[model samples]
Target: IKQLDSLKIDLSKTAPKKENLYFKNGVLYKKGILFAKGIEKGRVLDQFLKKINFKPKSVIFIDDKLKYLDEVEKFCKKLKIKFLGLRYGYLDKKVNNLQGFICDIQHKNLKKIFCFIQLNRNGYFQIVIYFKNNKLSMLIF
Candidate 1:
C-alpha cells in the first residue's frame, strides 16, 4: 500500500479500496484493473484474430487448440485439423489478475448487463459497462 501511495496511481476507480493498491513481489503496483480486465481471454481472442488480418471465411488459421473454436466460429466454419489439448480459462492472465478496474463507470447509477463465464442456468460473473451517454454495454470476463 505504501508503494502505491508513492507511485500515485489508482488501481481501479470502482474498486478503489479493494484494488487500489497491490504489492507485486513486495514492490509498488499502479496499473488499472479494468484496462487489464477488458482484455481478457474472450476479448483477446476477438483482438487476436482481428490482428491476424483474418476475417473468418475471408481467412483462417488452423490450430490444434480447441478452446478457441468458438472464436474461430465467429468468422469461419470449421477446419479439418483436430483441436486436441485446449483449456477454457483466462486468456489475459496479466489483465485478468487485475481484479478491480472499472470496465464501466456511470455518473449516476444505471442498468448494467454483465456476462457469465460458464453456460449455466445460474450465471457466475456479471458484467455491465456504462458510457457517458447513458448507454450500456455488456462484457464477460
Candidate 2:
C-alpha cells in the first residue's frame, strides 16, 4: 500500500486498514482480494469460493507458473466452473533480455560505457550508462 502511495496512486477511498487484512491458513484477504502467499493456488481458490455468497459464472486465472495454472484448472473443473488459465511469460522474457543486455554491456565496455550499475532491494536493476559524448542514460527496472 505504501508503495502504491509513493507513486501517487490513492486507494484511501476504498482502502481497508492493515488490520482489516487478515490471514487464514497462510492466505491473506482484504475484502474481495486474496493474497495466497506460500499456499497452494487450488486451495486458495477453494477458500475464496467458499467465502463468496454467489458462484462465479467463469474464472480467469493467470499465473507465471504452469504448475499453479494446472492446480487452478483442476479445481475449476471439479467445481464445474468455466475457467481459462493463462500462463504468463512476458515478464520472464523481458527479465531474461534485460539480464542479457547487462551481461553484454559488462563483457564489452563496462568501464567505458557504464557509470553505475546496482541491484536494488526490490531486485530491480538500476543502470547508469554514459554515451560517447558524455550524455547520460538511466535504466531502472
Candidate 3:
C-alpha cells in the first residue's frame, strides 16, 4: 500500500466502495489490490469469491507458475465460472539465465557465518543460519 501511494497510483475508483481496505487471515486488501501470503493462490481466490455477495461471470488469473494457474482453473471450472489462466514465465526465464557465484574468499566467509550453504544448478543459493535464540532460519536467493 505504501509503495502504491509512493507511486501516486489511485485504485480507489476501481475498489469496492465499502470495506475496501483491511487485513484478514493471511490476506491483505488495499483498495483494488489483494495480496495473500502463506496460502495457495487458488485457495486465496476461493476465499475472496466467498466473501463477495455476487458471483463474477468470469475470472482472469495470471501466475508465473503453471501449477497455481491449473489449480485456479480447476476451481473456476467447478464453479462454472468463465476462466482464463495466463502463465507468465518472464521471471522464471530471467532467474534461469542468471549467473550466480561466490569467490573463494566470499565462500569461506559465508561458511563461517552460515550453518550451511548450497548452490543449486540454476545458480540459486540456499543458506541456513542459527540465531541466538536457537531458532533456525533458511533463506534462498
Candidate 4:
C-alpha cells in the first residue's frame, strides 16, 4: 500500500482528461482505484467502463493467466472491442538465479505462477510451466 501510495498520480501537474488508465485488482483504494471483489476478474473493467461512461472501440488485454485472458478477450469481442492478448513471461538477462524467483513465487502467492521458462533441446526451444493446487509444480521447456 505504501508503495502504491507513493506511485499515485501527480494530479496537480496534469490536467483532467476524459480517458484514464487504471490498474484493476481485488483491493480498493480510497482514491478511486477500480476494485473487483470475489472471483470475477473481467467485471472490474466492465464496471470501470460503465462508471466512466466511456465506450471504447479497441482494447488490449494483457495477462499471465491464459484462462482469464481468454475470458477478457471473449468479453471484448462480444462488445465489438478490438482485443489483443499478450501472454506475459518472465526472463532474466543478467541474473543466474531464476529458480530462486520461482521458489519465492510458489511460497508467497500459493496461486498461479505465470512465469514461463525457456529450455533448449537439440537447438529447439519451448516454454513450459506446471500449475496445480495453487502452486507451480514444475518449470521446464
Among these predicted structures, which one has the highest lDDT?
Answer: 2
User: What's the ranking of the predictions by TM-score, best on top?
Assistant: 3, 2, 4, 1
**What value does the lDDT take at residue 77 in candidate 1?**
40
TM-score for all predictions?
A: 0.22, 0.54, 0.59, 0.44
Local accuracy of candidate 3 as per-residue lDDT tens digits, 53-120: 54678888887668878988888888899999998775575467545443443454553454655433
Quote model 3's TM-score: 0.59
Q: List the residue pairs that clash in candidate 2.
A: none
After superposing candidate 2, which stretches have Cα over 4 Å from the reference?
1-21, 95-141
**1-141 in candidate 4: lDDT tens per residue?**
333569976433332233344444543423434344444546666766775676777766665557778877877877889888886645332223333454465566454656544432221233445577766565442
How badly does each model clash, as a count of residue pairs? 4, 0, 0, 0
Ranking by lDDT: 2, 3, 4, 1
lDDT for 102 (candidate 1): 36
Comparing 1 with 4 on TM-score, the higher-scoring candidate is 4
Residue 83, candidate 2: C-alpha displacement in angstroms: 0.3
Scanning candidate 2 in windows of ten residues, the lowest lDDT window is 12-21
State the number of backbone clashes in model 4.
Answer: 0
